[model samples]
Target: MTTAARAPLQLPWRTGLAYGALAAPLAFVSLPLYVNLPHHYASVAGAPLAALGGVLLATRALDALIDPALGRLADRLFRQGKGQGHAWWAAVLGCVLLALGFAALWHPPKDSATAMLVWLAGALLLTTLAYSAVCILHQAWGTRWGGAPAWRARVTAWREGATLIGVLLASALPLWLGFDATSALLVLGLMLGLWSLHRLKLPVAQLADPVAPSPDRPQRSPWANASFRWLMLVFMLNGVASAIPATLLPFFVADRLQAPQWQPLFLLGYFGAAALGLPLWVRAVGRRGLAPSWRAGMGLSVLAFAATPWLGAGDGAVFAVICVASGLALGADLALPAALLTGVIHQGGAGGQSEGRYLGWWTCATKLNLALAAGLVLPLLSWAGYRSGSTDAAALQALAWLYAGLPCVLKLGAALALWCAERHHPTWRHTT
Candidate 1:
């Protein structure tokens, strides 16, 4: 069915906030996994860098590979919900699994290096699986509630804004409150977010919903669409650009800046700017289209990163400014692409049925970016005579290049790809 046939989503700010509540906890949990996990495992547990890299690569790749299947499972559960209990039950189960897995991961159950590695692997896999289920279901639910560009942007903004708050909390809490307390907070946030989610009036799914094409019909893969392929290409490159810095930030702060104490300030500057910039980005989407606005963000990011190479030790103040600038760019990064994807789903007439599938693949790409950053980049840095906590000038310079130079190159590539895609596929403008 065409999008015009469906009941339009009219989300007031209150409803949007309620629907987006879960995003905070999800993002809160993510910071430790991406930003803190490798450092913790390496320093605290004493896992060999190469071995740790290999394990992370293998498990995250495995997780990435399964996202599509998990997406399918999420779709089935969503369909089964049909105003029944399937979706709610699945989400609850996912939350329980996530809490258990996260607790085990942060508070390692074993002391021996080998046992710790094994436990880390198992726990990461479980955490990742639960994360995928909840993420795909939530994304699909939002997609099913379709709306106009500004409205859709508002929905995405609320979620992503909450996500920034979560990231801010995660970044700060571990430094001050410690991992144990952080874990407790995550559990609390998850419970509260889930409760808030139930307050949003979700649309009921019909048995033979037109928005969901018949399962029996020959279905074209999401990749079959030119717009999707182009968008995914841009998303992957942009994601890698963002993920590289994320993977390296702690190390950069500890080594290059020589001020580990400033870590929370940097994170706060970045995420706080992102949260504050969401409203401006939503307005930019209303003025320009998604692709153009996203391209603008890319440009801003490159400009911000361009200054990083010159930053030396005790440049925390300068770095904080960079963080705010890049974080403003991050608002566009977080909000626009997801809104564009929802538009793609509706255009394909697969809003209710295949959103999970599309978003599943999207999740795969997202994980792949993180995997490449942690799995490939870290090991490469190790090979290049750069070790974490090293004060060697040469090693610090190398760290700077990896942390700064690489992302600039990737962001430029993403910007170019976005331009090419928009040049050829102009139809996406109206959708955005």
Candidate 2:
């Protein structure tokens, strides 16, 4: 059951599509949770912004911390029953909780502020926990598929491409169909994804050596691996580079560009470009290998963001070009890193045994990057005299620098680190 034996030279389109289908719903749920939920509570539910933020912060922090545990749970489930039966059941249960919790979150009780706040906390906790569990499980399932570098890139590309489509739908649908209808769509999507998963036959887990850790034996921790740590370092740096712009996008659109009317178009173009570029990046992986392709993406991102400081009120068109270019680079970010992580797991001797653990930490790092972006950037922006609608020249300049310039610097750092990792680190040096 070695990786090469399991991974064929070519993966069927049907198999890739079926394995990736679940990601759409999972991603569909994520957009509303982060972007729309707070707005709904504040404007629609009349919840205090401060109190709402507190509840969200607490619940999300708890959710991120528990991902590793959930990853371990996924590992245990994979070990249960025949093949992935127990894991599949767990995912089904997670989907049920996710749908219910998501529905409840949007339809909060119209009671006292305290009661509504309490309900929000409870619902959010349930939804986020379920989301994390299902997400980690799905990732573990894919990692256990155990493919060559190109096949692994294709696997991640399909999943991430579906995710971009889901994000696009979630972004637009709520505006057109409203929350109730959108929630219904989410439920339906979840059901479809779950059914696909039930029908799909994933590759079985395998170990490089015969005497690796058994099902009952204590598994090695992902943190204990030097390669995992190095990969995470690169991941976190790049993640923060990406997260800063995401956290500041609306403000940048409203104030920097002074064209809030075009915000949707910007988002659409960005994600659309990413989705469209997935194939090209997969092809790039086939040509240049994973680490090199990822560094190239980081380089592309930096070049795209370099023009941001010069963009002003009437520069929306120019900014849109930047979005499209950076979004193309995003294809590599989404597809290659996780593929590299899969290779890391196998190379580190934890392939099938600890895929869940590794992905759990990976998910944790992603969440923490988002959290860190918001936690540090907003306060720093305010301290520098930038506000939501401020037109002050200095303030706007600060916003531009924080939103665009900072990420470029960070991306360069990440790109450098990636190069160093590939050149120096034994675990990362091999072709993925």
Candidate 3:
């Protein structure tokens, strides 16, 4: 009981943010993995841009494919407790694999297209699997510790706030210092992540509900729990809304904004704002309640995204403000979903063993969001006469629509889905 309970208090507020510090390195790595890897292959590895893009498409699909099994593995490891099953060890393995993958991809030797493909594919697979496992466990660990609305919000806020700081650090370090600094930060970040993982509070299952039988390892019985299925549906719809803008932001900035200089500025503001605003949102979550707080986030996201299509050249000021506003909205986005998911976990009677299974599904939704975002945006942008670097007014307008309008529409869809979830179900709520 003591050991399970000790998992949550691994660090103080500032130090727990160290756990969030892991986000910086992960995001920094994601820079190359999703956002910049293709570019590197094209320019440095001499892979033709077309071939490189295809390779990325194939490899990323593979990476996303293997995530659910890994998620389930995490569930089992966590189920048996950290020492017995080596849950922290498993997470550390993934973290180290992530860093090594970056190192391998960054400093490749055999500069052939085939070599690059093999190397990139191998690395991406390991990293994605590891990331999915670590994140799912991290989320489950948080959710396992049931609490009041404010405390739950605080738990998520600590994680998201660290992620924001990491984003800022990753953004600034590489730009100002260089890749070597990036490498150093990643090493330090992983150490912190491991340390924090050791300290993170796991739910004292015995204390939580002695009368309520503990959940054991999850099986392939997801829909067997109907409420979990419905919540997942809502999550999937909303996740796609968030993913659309993420996939197209770089394209929008480079081509439409025609102001590459402001790219980092915009991202920094948005992510930085998310880190800063987390505490405030936690307060709102406490006062307004989880359902209402989540509703507020969805509403803000829809409103802020809607304003995106109206900006233009020299609209940096407006865009900057939008970035800040949307990021504040992001604060809620980060905290509430996981909190709600935890509620779902408790309610679905999955409390005994399905943490990993539920989180695995959650990870699947996350990857699907990214895939759908890219699958929808990239092809749509191309079809709309928006090429990679075209500045034609019509093309730029299409870019704006892809970046802003489409996401807004999707966000509204997500909002509607959540409304349905709120009205229809509370099976996940268990007052044990």
Candidate 4:
């Protein structure tokens, strides 16, 4: 058990809630960058699917590579902030960069396809760098506030729950208010979130002081811990499974379901259910422990999504049910992994100092998963003759198989990895 888990700690309710506001704008920007960017460039700017995919692949690859370095920078800021709050300044700078890059992305000054792609590459790189720094800092902040498993669960839930609200808002706003209004909302939310963060008192880094030293407490890399590696293996497998659906959902709904109008509803249902399920999952964690809770959620998701391939055009309702069930599973996805990671960080003796590094690598894994989903799946779909807005039966069939079948297979792999870790890995078993 972790040191934090041996004693009870309670975050003030208001402070817990206030920090979560930051997740909203972060997520607001994410839905557009990952989900909408490809479709926007492909259809609106007339960039070919292959070319757009290449751009995303290249840019996100670079972005993912930068995460560990950025994470180290976040650690420096945390250490420096022992006397003066340099971390806040860094976070503010990140939010500024995020807003500017986001504006430039949606409203590119370029007109031609090549010019637009160039703009996208530059803007996405800038935005993602800023996003990574801020996210690593924010997550590390929460990690420092850790207590028991239930406390960690509550922290993750508040943040991820707010993230779901942000995603839900992002998905619906583009349709209801259009891109201009949606972009404006993102800016507004970013400003407000930063403001709230500025006012909220953050958890102090107990080991952030440079002058302090415990010669016995050497700082090893987060990767030196075997438990972290096993957790990450499970996390990446599960992440790929989740990201595949996210990448394909718009196409599936528009073409496969023939219910383009239901697009917002599907997104809303998924995110909203995930938000609603967060508390329940947290409660489950309190009873079952993190590993069991997470495995149970994974099992539930495989069963729920297995039925996805059977649904057809008029099955929007069925899909909505699938969305809810799978999204309930999403609550576990969002809450448990990070909560378990907190224990891993505590065990690695990096709780206050190197949490940023761990989260930074976690961020890299996240970006890699999205990049792989887009890089591999998009090009493969194009190669298979599945064009956006195409009504070809063969194309649609290929899409269905890739979208629904592939994720279930990946989920099963992730579940098996989790099982093996539980049975064979002593560190993983003891930590939980």
> After superposition on all CA atoms, how large is the RMSD of candidate 4?
3.1
Report the poorest 10 consecutive residues by lDDT, candidate 1. Answer: 203-212
As a whole number from 0 to 100, the lDDT of residue 332 in candidate 3 is 77
Candidate 4: segments with Cα more than 4 A from true spot: 1-10, 109-111, 203-216, 424-432
**All candidates: TM-score:** 0.94, 0.90, 0.85, 0.93
lDDT of 2 by residue, 1-432 (tens): 333344554678898788889999887788777666755676678876556656666676777899888988888888777888899899999999998998888878887999998998899889888999999998887888666778788889888988998988887787678878988898899899888888888754332322333456566788887777878989999999998888677778888899977877887888899999899988887778888889999999899889898788999999999999999999989999998898877766676688888988888888777667665776677678865678899989998998899999999999988888887654333343
lDDT of each: 0.83, 0.81, 0.67, 0.82
Root-mean-square deviation of each candidate, in angstroms? 2.7, 3.0, 4.2, 3.1
Name the regions of candidate 2 deviating beyond 4 angstroms.
1-6, 37-57, 107-120, 204-218, 426-432
What is the descending TM-score order?
1, 4, 2, 3
- What is the number of backbone collisions in each predicted candidate, taken in the order shown? 0, 0, 13, 0
- The C-alpha local distance difference test score for the whole of candidate 1 amounts to 0.83
Task: After the best TM-score superposition of candidate 1, give how far the Cα of residue 182 lies from its true spot, in angstroms.
Answer: 1.2
Error of 2 at 22 (Å): 0.5
In terms of lDDT, model 3 sits at 0.67
- On the 0 to 100 scale, the lDDT of residue 360 in model 1 is 90
Which candidate comes out best when scored by TM-score? 1
